[model samples]
Target: MRKSPAAKAWTRCAVSGIAAAVALSASLSGCGLPAADPGNPGRPVAAAAAAGSQGAAGNPAAVTAGSRVLNPANGRLEAVVPEVSRTVLLIGDSQSEPVDGWPRLGLAAAGYNVYFCGRGGTGFVSSNGATGNYIDALLRGDWLLPSGTPALIVIQGGGNDAAGAASDRQITANAERLIAELRERYPSTPMAMIGTLARGEAHGGGRRTEVDALLGSVAASHALPFVSVGDWLTRYGLAKDLADTVHMNPAGRQKLGVLLEGRLRDLGLDRKPTADQQPLRASGTRDDGPGQD
Candidate 1:
């Protein structure tokens, strides 16, 4: 009643194949880029282009997505979610990691689902149509919510656009376009755009200040509530809080989330900062108001 040698060899081979397949599946699922649904067939967005944009010259190496820092080479940390949940789509550099993005923890603490769309090295200006400027991609991809509307959309970006190579006016203009596009797409969704965090020697001290001012102007022009994390960094004193001259560490991200919760509440996105946030500010700007040209 003994099995043949050939039979035993086949069994081992089958088990090895199954194990390999399982491991591959697990890896993909964890990354949150599962293959497109079979029943409802359509092409998924161009992930290659998205990946390239994150790696473009002078961009950050990582991005915060959901509750993880996404490595472009490997989508690492893209799918993992913290226990408490409510989605906040982030758009920014490594400075916006889920733990660093703060809104993920803040909104989740207040009971909401959060998703991180943190794209490293992304800017408001089009990368020559490469990644479709964050706002344009959001609208085209319907990034608001699964129901086509989200409770809140938090944007943190533009640090790269603050380059000396580009005039302050140019940076400001690009940011304005970003805000305008978002307004046109998701008119009623409450949005909060964060200013850059810390300044570095790259722009000299003054250029950083100019960047913050231009960002503030964009928020005001759109009438969307703004959170000046850059200003907050100055007020809080940078040396101790920052992990580096530029980005913050995990502890820093937690502080940011706590501060941002209040801003969302003030803008009427959340009721009391301790409870579920409600959408307060109308989604679209004056120009893109409901049914208005």
Candidate 2:
């Protein structure tokens, strides 16, 4: 029988970029968020302020969960101050999907309202037969946050591109384009990039290593923080956490989440909640670990 498209995509990522794929999967899955509540979708950090509550002079009467407040003095949204509950925009591939990834969980744990946009089999330089590459998706406005401007924007990928053998020039050009577009849109917001993942003894080390180096160079040129988790599985003793060669098991996912949370904190991207703010939690369960597949 022929493999399904989803299956084929998974196979391609695994076969071409198994080390990268596994590392990405571990980083994301390990940091999975608590299941979302049906009543309160998306904006998990804090409850919405009461409607008609006064904000700065010219701002809207109702303060939505993640909406920008109008600055009465300046009469412009641009002057709006960062709220106690910050917002984060995360863009990546299957590994960092919003469903239950570490980026989502780590940010949420840090009292952030996370907007995640990720597609399986997609990357900075290659789409792995998906609809569009990262640049195309960003240009088309595929993964924008709904309301307020994100305080932090994170871009994660390159595994698929490395696996697909995307040229360094292609990767660098697309990354630059993506950064330029983001800067134009959110000039003041801080940005960061998480590079491709890898295992220490992987056979495809050459390409994955090259992709990691290219990503580092791009981040440096753009003056953005770059976190490389390529050898996380081996370095962190997470080899036994693999559900497969390219995906993490439940235990591995938990470990990855802890590791990522620390990284985010170390970079100063993840902040603790203020006294009045509360961390987001699911209605039923407190434990946010990924369920059995």
Candidate 3:
């Protein structure tokens, strides 16, 4: 039987800042959650990069977080650590869940490494029967990120909320609270949002699109950069690419990943220029290259 709000996970790892290159150890604890919707297996802290990036491969799947040593110095559960500008913390659901999916593929292509806090059947307000909602889980230590600050934080999902029975008000409240919490934790880090994937009503799109728009509003309220893909399937004519009504096939995932890569680039979410360094391209194959699982 299928259960709503099933997957919950977070990956932890730390790399020194480029300018400083000072190595700092961070302790992270998160149990892997299988992506329940499609029954995808869980992935630990994985690393992907272009040829010249960290891993030194054309398309290396990822180097799990196991490769790193954790420091129990202060013993804070989710202690504060230094910022690594090349890493991104991603929270998502089925449309592009995690470990392997369009969002991961796209972000990899954009030259950013990922530390995913992904879960299927989970969303802002839609609590997974197994893991609770996003905000509560983070607060209660259900999911703990690496001690260090990531370059950017991205919240990606709304399918669960759209499918869930939670009211719009509840969703907004939870989303707002999560954002505020993250802001407090990583005040200097940039944040972005990837809205719910939808086909639009003409193609049987329902509350998914509505929730996408609602999330967009929420992101805007906080001045968070947002990407709206509510009408992507219909707009991009990817109907044939869908494995079913909602999920996409491998080809679709690649296409969507490419689309997302460009979108993130345009939005300056992937590699926004810092005060010290000029914005430069992250290494990765522009076409037909992804460090996917």
Candidate 4:
């Protein structure tokens, strides 16, 4: 008897110790959120092509305080400074949980103060009995930070939904509801969505393909930057970087951080470190709290 692809993926996830990752997510502590870098107070850091552009090297240029640049990724023209005046919010599932997950690390590396709200095994449409689903959490104010409004918001999920065989209509409806709620709350805040993960060559043909497509369509309708990182592991030659079928290891996490930095830069959403900004800790631990559900 042959194992189904879904079973194979699930087996890989279990073998990779995803359970441990969830435990780690729960034990993590929030860092002492730092202020902007104090060295260049009040001055806007100028964006240099080398520092702001995403090329084949996959390396993100160091952003200075108060720089303005055109992001080649999403063709959005915007300033990178003033980010110091706000925070960034990330909402996602297990893949984006764990203090050291790529999305959180990447946003922090790019000079933004980040607040992450991740629930392992949860998705835009899937509910974690404790905190409910992403939309429910937001609606109930369970994920709000104890500070100012976020300058940007990023939503990452779909893997769990796809794995569970959630219907296309279900995913889309839930996604639209999530986006609508977010827009109603923060009408002007910039938002982006990331799709499911998969092997490089198998991306467009993988199990989560439909979920990814629906996510892209939703993003398109909202005119938001929608990043499909399914092939990132294979595209960047980080196959060995995966800790499981869907999660990234430390090395993989670092690589993903760089990739996300480049993507944010491309979307003109990269943050410029303020003079008061503090440096990222070597341990890469700056989460606000444990996974809620």
Candidate 5:
């Protein structure tokens, strides 16, 4: 197990909400709000007031539970793993498509099975051209989850909304709608948000960072524990860590996973589920320790 002395130190940070996120960003080598490129300046994003895969693998062509599968969407493959109890439901986009991706590895390190629900190019209201948005997918039964209530319901996405034509208000409205539905379905379950992984202006960061802050505002409004990673690329000096214009390479993914684990500790969202949410463990899965089988 990778003991988290770093995570333990991070839990002491007073980054209670995204408001503190600005300070955190500013503190990191001047990694403050991204430079204006998408026609919007810094900090005004938060002033807008909130609006709104795969894993484990070592395979490409194979389609196992922890491998890539054809996305229910129109374009390429997405990561997937079967649902299990004592899990965290991650609903997000292509950024979360790697079965061995950032948040999945981070959350697994935090001690929980993960079940992903969204695919590439999708967000709260934005679609991947074929599959519906997060809310629409849930309503249309495009993404099915396990029967039992999971430990936590984490809503993560914003890149698609930011990149696509959806306005901030539309993103907020759809996000709220999705949250309302999730609250109805899992009343006792706690929820959280992870903002978009982004870069600075020099790295083509603009609307994506803006959407990250906007989602932070939304999470703040809902009083959800939000991890604002909007400035992460520039902050962590990850310019070379990208696999593409929008996604991260394996090295970048690993580094961000560690960073995310620390943030989860900071927000006190790293604990495992309670007795009620801890149903019988699924077969072939072992609860040896945090991040371990």
Candidate 6:
């Protein structure tokens, strides 16, 4: 409809106000979160690139530790069997709560073929409250073990599950079903259930014990290794070490990476690089393509 100049001006003003409000809402939603730092890499083992950098020149321990952490031999888990052949599948929420620089750092340092299959707000329970189809979609999708049978499957989720309207039994059952499917699909693969970390004061005391018990029982029933972050948080004082209620800071991520590195090693799932090998990250796809579940 035709409008006078004054009316047109008012319409423009209203549109601009709406845009401003939308932008402000987005900004507010991102509060209390660490902006993704590709530089941080979140690897428990230091990166080789960083090793030659000025930082590592001064601190040689960083490089040595990186090699040690990545060296499958140094991983002393008796159950691991220390094999050079293995790949990793990382499934979790934002608070799968990795240790330092993550995905880039931790996966790289560990030298495993890591497929990070985590989506924000998706959890073992709720299935996004029956409306969200992340899990079912993932199962039908093709996000896991691209290199073939992964020696280990690391399910690092449950934070969102706890918050979801679904019952604890439902969450635990879903997780168990997932593990059972993995076992059926890849019988040789060992499943590792990494429990969610404790949120600091913001969550009114984290690590829902009810959920923990459920996860533990399911993991035990399946004979899968269960690593609880609850002990780490209690031992380390989560409030002091955590960056926030859920996510960990750089130091926290690193510490968590160290713990996972050990766990992965014990599973005999850590891989080593060969002289002729090229780094996977140099050619890795940020998107593993499409979901399969």
**Model 4 TM-score, all chains together:** 0.64
Can you write out model 2's per-residue Cα lDDT over 266-293, one digit (the tens) per residue? Answer: 9887755578765431100112123211
Taking the tens digit of each residue's C-alpha lDDT, what string does model 5 give over 65-135? Answer: 33333333332232234443456777777666555556665665565666667667678877765568988
Model 1 spans with C-alpha error above 4 angstroms: 1-87, 126-132, 139-147, 199-205, 271-293
Reference-based TM-score, model 1: 0.56
lDDT of 5 at 17: 24
Displacement of the residue 24 alpha carbon in candidate 1, Å: 22
Candidate 3 structure, TM-score to reference: 0.68
Model 6 stretches with alpha carbons more than 4 Å out:
1-85, 96-111, 127-134, 142-147, 199-207, 266-293
Off by over 4 Å in 5: 1-85, 200-204, 273-293
For every model in order, what is the number of clashing pairs?
15, 9, 2, 15, 7, 26
Pick out the ten consecutive residues of candidate 4 with the lowest summed lDDT.
Answer: 26-35
Tell me which of candidates 1 and 2 scores higher on lDDT: 2
**What digit string (tens of lDDT, one per residue) describes model 4 on residues 1-293?**
99996456445434333323432332221121123322444433222422443321364344433333444443322233323255676778776776667776666556566556657777877776565677776655444222224678888888778777778888889899999977766667789998876664464436566677789898999898988876776676777776766777766765677677667778787765558865332112332233221
Residue ranges of candidate 3 with Cα displaced over 4 Å = 1-83, 272-293
TM-score of each predicted structure versus truth: 0.56, 0.65, 0.68, 0.64, 0.65, 0.55
- Model 2 poorest ten-residue lDDT run: 281-290
The lDDT values for all models are 0.46, 0.57, 0.60, 0.60, 0.61, 0.47
Instruction: Select the stronger candidate by lDDT from 1 and 5.
Output: 5
